[model samples]
Target: MSTDPHANQFGELAWFKSSYSGTSGGDCVEVAATPAAVHVRDSKRPQAASLTISAEQWSAFAAYARQA
Candidate 1:
């Protein structure tokens, strides 16, 4: 088992699927916030790889997304 506390750590995470995510379950993205970082994953593949981005980076990404 991995020693990393954040590994396989989706449980209890307040995952919020993007507003753009439709009921058809296509192109769905989920985000979770942590004290030290922001976690992003695909809703269709919850157990798959996730992207761990720093809070600052996440904020920048969010700002960019808003403008896009």
Candidate 2:
């Protein structure tokens, strides 16, 4: 939740938004994934703080989300 916005460490990751997000600029979520970790951020605030989690944790969360 605390990566320097100007750092290039995460700049190389290809981030993408959800297809379910509206085109009219409402709330949106974006994601980027590496072999070891997954990154999540608000689409409306790309420069703001983002969240990083392990791939295994993402898998578990995705599974729970699917159930909900």
TM-score to native of every candidate shown: 0.75, 0.82
Indicate the residue-level lDDT of 28 in model 2: 88
lDDT of 2 by residue, 1-68 (tens): 43656234545667898777869999888898988888899988988888989999999999999999
Regions of model 1 farther than 4 Å from truth? 1-11
Worst 10 residues of 1 by lDDT: 2-11
Tens digits of per-residue lDDT for model 1, 18-61: 66676997888888898778988888888777788999999999
Q: What is the lDDT of residue 17 in candidate 2?
A: 88
lDDT of 1 at 55: 96
Model 2, runs deviating above 4 Å? 1-11
Best by TM-score: 2
